[model samples]
Target: MHRTLLLLVVGVSLAFGVDWFLGEFIEEYVVRIINLCGIAIILAVSLNVINGLCGQFSLGHAGFMAIGAYVSAYFTTTLRVLNTETGETVVRAPLFDGAWGFVPALLIGGMAAAAAGLVVGVPTLRLKGDYLAIATLGFGEIVIIMLTNFESVGAARGLPGLPNYASSFWILTFAWICVVSSVFLQRSTFGRALVAIRENELAAEVMGIRVARLKVMAFIYGAFFAGLAGGLLGHLLRTISPSTFGFMKSIEVVVMLVLGGLGSLTGAIVGAIVLTVLPEALRDVEQQAKLPGIRMVVYALVLILLMIFRPQGIFGQRELSLKLLRRLLPGGRK
Candidate 1:
């Protein structure tokens, strides 16, 4: 409960802060970008569970996102059910109106993704390291390909008729949920077991940790959040395409984890926010000038520098809890 309260307070406060300081910019465009950042945080932190904590290298997150996006899109798209009265459609968006429609769709999307994760993880979790990565990468590619072939989902065309409902409020709420859940999991005995497995699977097996189960659970949980993020993003954008959830998207989330520092929740959130917003900040250049892929080039430089100097990452496996600061500051604690 304390953790939940903290999450609520912090997330709400941050939302208000952004609203205040960024009121102008946000009114124009930053609002949507901030929402995207929140979703990115969800993806990064969730991926951190599978990659940073469990030491798994699965890369099929985009596939899971595509699955969830299509499922959720089906629920709230105008293209679904229509009213017979005057031939006007009874449109129900996934919360573009700040109503109750968005929440349930997002949860359902997360569940569907989680179910998919279980299916995939059950078979693939047995693999480890680079093999796991390759398998997941293939999974993502397969999902994209499958999306292209599905006629009901618009096939090669983009999925549409979605209501734009994503907002900073919803975005921050999801971010807080991801952060708090991650922190809770990390502090639990199960978290300890996961860490043990990550450190040494052979030793953890001897120590009675169900390595496969833990690994599968991590993958499922990671995919669940990934889907939730995708649903939110799709609704916000009011459209979906297989291309949106692709290998590069998965790589972007992983890069967020790496740049923020693996094994650190704070770092993951920071990395996601920075990366999510940075590209948008450069959008002006793209519109009025020629800045093709400049974001990637600058990002590559920063990554190279970070690898050379602080390969351990920004937090270096250390959490950003206030307790650490309080301890270091002598009288900083309440």
Candidate 2:
């Protein structure tokens, strides 16, 4: 316990130090990229719980993200007050200026997304493989379409003028929390059961594991964090539209998981960082070469090369830790 507390302290200190240093020294564009990386990290890690750890193919991550973003934005942008004497209601601007209000708004968004996950997971988890993927894809489309038609959350126009409340420090803190929670869960009994189900569902069932229940739990868990990421993204961008969390957004998150390594937490983080930076890094090259879609072409080439060379992904279910780092270092632990 003491060691754990000490590690936590050190981790927080390092996080804060990095956050401050980057804000102080880095250019605005570079800092924005870093903040986006943090958000991507949260999304990738959260999706890993379902697609990587649970061996489920879900494509509706963006739908949940949309739910979170809209719900959180609503709380932060729209405020309602009731008069005690006149029994009249007044609507005011959103109030998420402080951490106390911001935290609850984010949590409510996450909870709402988790509830949606529960509703979706209970009925659809029975499907497997491509069928499951199609189902989830449909769900994502349905969400976007609904939001597009719904006028309450700013139909096709999108909600704007939101308060920019998501700082690099807050984003990193939440991302770290997601990472630690995912890592610990992967080391727990529930995680083992998930792995077993991934390997062989029938055998897992024969072993007395509640397959359906576990699947639902995994979905809920992943959706909760995805929602959290969405909330962070909404506040960071200070504007959100239904189109922002579309099929392509879900594909982006999946690419991070695949590029990293399924079932590997460290791989997800690394993949998120690399992929998030890749386009920005290529911007100069693209402009200089006068090439449209050059960035994507290069990105595709890299993915193709990776597939040819390391099909199991960069990590292949392995994690990066102090012990592993030591073993890889020259003249270090073997």
Candidate 3:
């Protein structure tokens, strides 16, 4: 079903998009929304490692992504993404054809984000409980404020001219990378260690698990994907504003976790996709005027109801596997 749905989506997108591109109507805007969904998946699932599996509440996701985006954008631009004081436009590279030039920029941007995960993780991972959350939140704020204050990088004005490279293809590809990497980690011994820590750091510590070290590793990896997502976001809009990676942005990522049920990577992906599509569907169909933020309000209400009723989430920790089928379908489960 997953494969079928994905193929159908791609086929429709290509058919409609090609027709639009060649027609007088210009292009289908839905492609951008699909790309946005792909990035959201990365942000939601990657954060699930520490926030969900490890039972750590983190809201600093946008900060890490911003770090990656700024660094990557800084280097990719002709100006080298250097912090600007005089307010400069981030010059875009001329596209070679239609896609390749912009595509490579995103890859380089993702690598830059991975590097930031390691750098920022080293120091901040030491704190625990509220202290850790505060520290991460502070880091995010610091990133946003720094970008806002740095006049050379355009300060609050934001930088523009980035190559819009985040197409449906790239978004889907990287989203898959995030999905596979996170799922593999969860099933591995190291992943289980994260679970151990999540359950009780004191117990994990007594058992000789390097709790602090694992937390840092998870944070860094999470930051890496967040950054990659930011890169995709920047390219999608062709602009980089300091406010783009704000605390509220981080909260949205958390919402995906909450809606999908904490600790389930698959849940996070589902939540992200559902939310992404909901907005588009709502905008297209809704006739009555509503608050611009109504979507989030609805999301919040749904989350509240989920926590009250099915607190374990859509599947909880029980992953989707063929093993479950054996008991229900006799030979079919196998």
Arranged by lDDT with the best first, the candidates are 2, 1, 3
lDDT of 3 by residue, 4-94 (tens): 4675566556545643553444355665666678889999999999798777677789987887676666655544344356665554454
Worst 10 residues of 3 by lDDT: 89-98
Instruction: Kindly list the per-residue Cα lDDT of model 1 for residues 1-334, writing each as its tens digit.
Output: 8857877788878776765666555475656677788889999999999888988887888888888787877776756434556766554543333447777878888999999899888998668788989988998999899889876667878788677666676777788778888989999988888889889999999999999899889988998998898888898888899999989988888888988888888989888988888777767666677868776777778878988999988877888777887877867756
lDDT of 3: 0.75
- Could you tell me which 10 consecutive residues in candidate 2 have the lowest summed lDDT? 78-87
- Backbone-clash count (model 3): 8
The lDDT of model 1 is 0.83
Per-residue error (Å), model 3, residue 31: 2.4
Model 2 scores a C-alpha lDDT of: 0.88
Candidate 3 is scored at a TM of: 0.79
Report clashes for each candidate as comma-separated counts: 1, 0, 8
| Winner by TM-score | 2
lDDT score, candidate 2, position 328: 92
